[model samples]
Target: MKFIEEVVVEEFLPTFRSMLAGELRERGLTQSEVAELLGISQSAVSKYAHGDVDINDAVADDERVRETVERLADGLETGDMSRVQALVEAEILIRKLERGDLLANLHEAAFPPLSDHEGPLDIHDPEGDLRTTERVLSSVRRGVRTLENTSGFAALIPAVGSNLVEALPDADGIDDVAAIPGRILDIKGQATVPGDPEFGVSEHVASVLLAARAAGSDARAALNVRYDEDVVAKLDAAGYETVEFDAEADVESAIAEALESNPQPDVLYQTGGFGIEPVVYLLGADAGVVVGTVRDLV
Candidate 1:
């Protein structure tokens, strides 16, 4: 069985080393100088520089890789970054990219069976950005699927359209929240998902979720739907704490103020303003729970 680490050592290293060596050479460093800096033999440097070693184009052409190489070359040449520091930086990037990013994709490609492997691999950091991001994306997918399957879900879509969103555990901004790229729309009584979910896409729903979190709510997922008195009343009857926020003011501050007294509201609504359409937002533990709540309610 070929381990994923083998792919990294066999492909990533040669490509990165070659690129770095070439960068150093372009900056007037001799092969010996490059070898000394890289802690490799001069012959190895020549081999890499001469294209004798097969290079991974994906590794070479990665935007992060190019930027890192340029920065490392400048630092190494200027003695700003120590050899150990350079190695550590590269190692960190490698580790990050290996966790559900480019390197992980490469590993799965090289080992097809691994593509079907369940859960985070031992090679991936459990809390790494790639894994966590994928988890959020997956959660959003489940929620969206729930909506797509639920009967009458389309009628619930507000005039402005609907979005299902979930945030990372420690989401700091919109980029940390994953949601449908385009808002879910009702077309001919059907809920149409324009594209797959991605991070930093849902501004209105994501903003409300983040605002609630800032106001002491633990809700990490939120879904928006058309608002009505019956809807709000049913949520309250079902023991969901509901809060109404000003639709005109800033969304973040408005939700914050509304939840100041009722900190852990399960439902938040805003009546139609001069131009704002009335909507109800459901908050829950994750995308699945939030969408499930909507399915049960509607």
Candidate 2:
């Protein structure tokens, strides 16, 4: 009888432990010290040290995982955040990720028979928006990484620089959206991220996203790139619905009217105005899928 929690214990735990152990070691902790800090055996820490533990790439690559491990490792080393708090933090992330999220997806993939089920969001809501905030940050980071890694994406950055953003579920204002601070700039044919993803840092993309949502679009994520007639043609050729809006008009009303003909557009663009730079906005269910669609263009 295999349970979902069993999947967590068997699959997620090892990778998480290994990462935490490695982080501690890098901070100059001995194997015995790491084992003590992590509440694990020295043998297990040694195994982790030797790379004997197989890691889930998806989990390891998650920004939340990296952040949490570093945070906890630092706490364990210098005694900032308590171990109990660290455990609670990790547990919160796991619970959050399991609910119709990455861990749940992994669980369903591991046992195809229960593919239709995604765990409900419950248990505890410690720090009301903590989990949700982390999820959005992680999603944006993933999308930004996708754009950074994709060849030719740098050329897509608009003159004003680009920003990748994701709105929280039922987001009503700019504060509810998370985005890269400042902007992702193009430097020497490379997309350079300025800082980590944070809430309410983006005004332009977030406004557009909220406007699109207010116009009845279900998209929660949006990314902007340099506008080009060829790019629009490629998006149309790729079977994505494209719409045009007036760049100088009221952005909310402009977007609202634009989506009227094609309510669920995959792409929205505005041509250059007297001073406004031309740009294209890609919208989707989440940051990852939006980035994937952009990847298709590449």
Candidate 3:
């Protein structure tokens, strides 16, 4: 049950901070100055200087980490880099190293199960597109968890089932959306997720999200639930922008037309047609927000 962040705090930060302290000292900075620059206690700096802290050899010996330390140390010593800029540079390097680099190896050492994953873990890449996509997936997972725990969430599931979906920042099609492989359904009074979430698993909700994006909505996440007029009125009274589309028409065109009138709607609903189930979609900036809106309905 250990998190990768625990490995980073216990292993990477100590080793990197100690090395940076040493480098700054060698560049003629006094212990007090180094402590001040590194934002650490003077005593902590003393421990790093006196070899009291254990350095992770893998991190200390990495060329990129070593170069970052040297560069920051030189900049700090010569007044070329402000403390804030030095901190940002070091942070960026740490993120770069965490993306299937040295820090990821250290993470594998701490949690062996991660080694079995399908591809390199880019969970720590703060600015990478992969990280952004992973975050969307994580938000959807949290939303699903919230719904599963809610006492009557299963009652909200449509006969066709429901799915929560989120699109990548630059999604082009269904393949770029993360969703449950099978729709969520109410089984024996419980909300059940049949399988793990994967890209391109959903067709209906994904198309709606893509259409919303194409229609210039900033929302990146959406969730579908059984529709009710009372629920729509509640959402509208609560200040959520609502739009209606024809269920009998093409889904994409219906959404486009609805959004063409209201560019940024928080809720989209359709009246049931013959043999078609009516559904209401909650939309927001991320899955967590979308789920929160659904929670409000509960």
User: Number of clashes in every candidate structure?
Assistant: 0, 0, 0
Model 1, 246-290: lDDT tens per residue? Answer: 999988889889998989999999997998899999999999889
lDDT of 1: 0.89
Q: What is residue 52's positional error in candidate 3, in angstroms? A: 30
Write one digit per residue (lDDT tens) for candidate 2, span 1-298: 4566877887889999999999999999999888877788999999999999989898888898889888898988998877789899999989888766678767777777554222343213544354566778899998888888999888889989999999989689998899999999999999999988888889999999999999989999999998999999999999999999999999999999998987889999999799999999999999998888878778
In terms of lDDT, model 2 sits at: 0.87
- In lDDT terms, which candidate is top? 1
Please rank every candidate by TM-score, starting with the best: 1, 3, 2
Instruction: Give the Å shift of residue 187 in candidate 1.
Output: 0.9
**Tens-digit lDDT track for model 3 on 186-278?**
999899998867788999999988988888889988999999988899898899999998999888787888899788999989988999999
Poorest 10 consecutive residues by lDDT, candidate 1:
115-124
Give the better candidate number (1 or 3) by lDDT: 1
Q: What Cα-based lDDT does every candidate model obtain?
A: 0.89, 0.87, 0.87
Candidate 1 regions off by >4 Å? Answer: 1-3, 12-123
**What's the TM-score of each model vs. the native?**
0.66, 0.59, 0.62
Q: Is candidate 1 or candidate 2 better by lDDT?
A: 1
Candidate 1: deviation at residue 146, Å? 1.2
